[model samples]
Target: MEFDLSWPVLWNGLFWPLIRLTFFISVGLLVGNLIESLQWTRYAAKLADPLARRARLGDISAASFTMAFFSGITANTMLSEAHEKGEISDRELILSNLFNSLPTYFLHLPTIFFIAAPFIGSAAAVYVGLTAFAAIIRTMAIVFSGKFLLPPIKEGCLPCRLDEMEKKRDTKSALQKTWARFKKRLPKVLYLTCPIYTLFFVFKQIGMFAWLQGFMSGSASFFTFLPPEALGIVVFHMAAEFTAGLAAAGAMISDTSLTQTQVILALMLGNVLSSPMRAFRHQFPYYAGIFRPRMAFKLILYNQVTRGLTIALVGTAYALLMT
Candidate 1:
């Protein structure tokens, strides 16, 4: 079983995708930063304050939650600073981070949707929409928990310090801030994206994904709920980047045999299976840098567990109702 390891095959597969993904991701980041620099997210934060207050979180924690919509790093940093100052307890610190997850998911929503749209068409919307729904559910659960478990705050105003956030807003024009952010973020994005994308392309050209699809087919009894072709989507998802799954699902979209619901279920299942590893690999380091290693691990554990359960619940309900 020979495969094309030729330069042309490698170049064609890697070049165009890397270009498209880079462009879309850059635009997404720029949009996110512009919204932040322009203070557009302030309104969202204002609206979320009622929810934060109901959860009995103090102004500092609520402010961190607001910061999350634009930059999760900054938001977590705020929480870490507050924790260090004893402005909030350990439990509040963790709960605040978890509460911010909904916005955190949204920080990359544009990138994910734009990337998936080209590959999976309308199903991209469905898949992203479902994941966003799961994020909302998880956040709501955190809010409910906070309401019951955490004591009330006597802070004069929940959104008062929200005005303090304006001090950090960029003075430059939106376009200038967007360009600066693009320059700063693009290199880091490409550093990781280039090697990983090239390796996945090589794997695809070399039949790695095909072999996994065969394995999934052989193990079909276990995943009885999903269609056979849909197994390839799950395989690609688990094997490589989320785009790999979209690519597989995209290919399957043209096949008249499979329904859109089946493709969505496969995506949801792939997301459920793949999220834990991704969190541990990508999130742990960042969290550790901000908080202690122990704290970071706790946050990651809570995040992955809660995320998995909520997404699974949404998937199960979707399957029952739609399929």
Candidate 2:
């Protein structure tokens, strides 16, 4: 066997995907950004104060819950400050963080859908759809839990500086703002997505995923719930992030004769299993650093359990329906 090397990585895996991704992402980002700027105002946090109040959170917590939509760190920092000030309790902290789940998911939905629609194709909708539904369920659970499990606030919420709070507004016209956001987000999406897409394709071409498939077959009984073809995707998800896992799932979707249901089930299953590790790696440290250790641990635990259950519920429904 002769060794070959000459922009193989660039031409072989990256070229078409780069071209396809560039066009789709450029257009999608523009459209998605415009929609975000024009349609949804950041005042959702202020607007959601009533719902948050019903859920037993005070003004400060509700405000933080709203801030979560734009920036989780901002939301979380506010939560920490409120916690330090005794405005919210441990229970409120846990519930509020969970309530922010939907917004946090929404925060990235545009980016994920726009990027995925092209890279992952038709399957992108299904993959994003299931998670969105799951996020919705988790949000519902938080609301109900807050209403039933926690007591409603009697004392007025702290006098958070609502007057000083500001929403991000661009001075430019919608088109200019869209163009600016599109340009800003485009490189970031491509930087993350392009390399992952390319690497996954190269790995597939060289048969890394094939080995994973073969490896999983011996233990197929372990994943009896998932279709045989999806085992590789599950493995990839368990080992890496959604980018690699979805990339693998997308390849199967585009190349193999796998049906949409199979792809959805596979990706969902991967999502179900992989979330805990992600929580540990990302959520755990961030929360611990910001919140007290025990509080962080509890918050992370609640979120992981809630998220896992939500995904599992969706996956079960899909599996049963498919069967």
Specify the highest-lDDT model's number. Answer: 1
Worst 10 residues of 2 by lDDT: 156-165
Q: What are the Cα lDDT values of the candidates?
A: 0.75, 0.69
| Model 2 agreement with the true structure over 183-250: per-residue lDDT tens digits | 76556655655555555556656766556545543453487766666877777766666777777777
- Candidate 1, position 21, lDDT: 63
Question: Model 2 off-target regions past 4 Å?
Answer: 1-45, 155-221
TM for every model, in the order presented, reads 0.69, 0.66
Question: By TM-score, who's the top model here?
Answer: 1
lDDT of 1 by residue, 1-323 (tens): 67786778766777776686667555555655565556554555566678888888766666667777877766775676558668789999989989999999999999999999998889889889999999999889988999888998766553455566657555667669667866875676566556656666667677876666455434434787787788778877877779888888888888755788899998888887777766765565445545666888899999989998999999899888984
Please give the TM-score that candidate 2 achieves against the real structure: 0.66
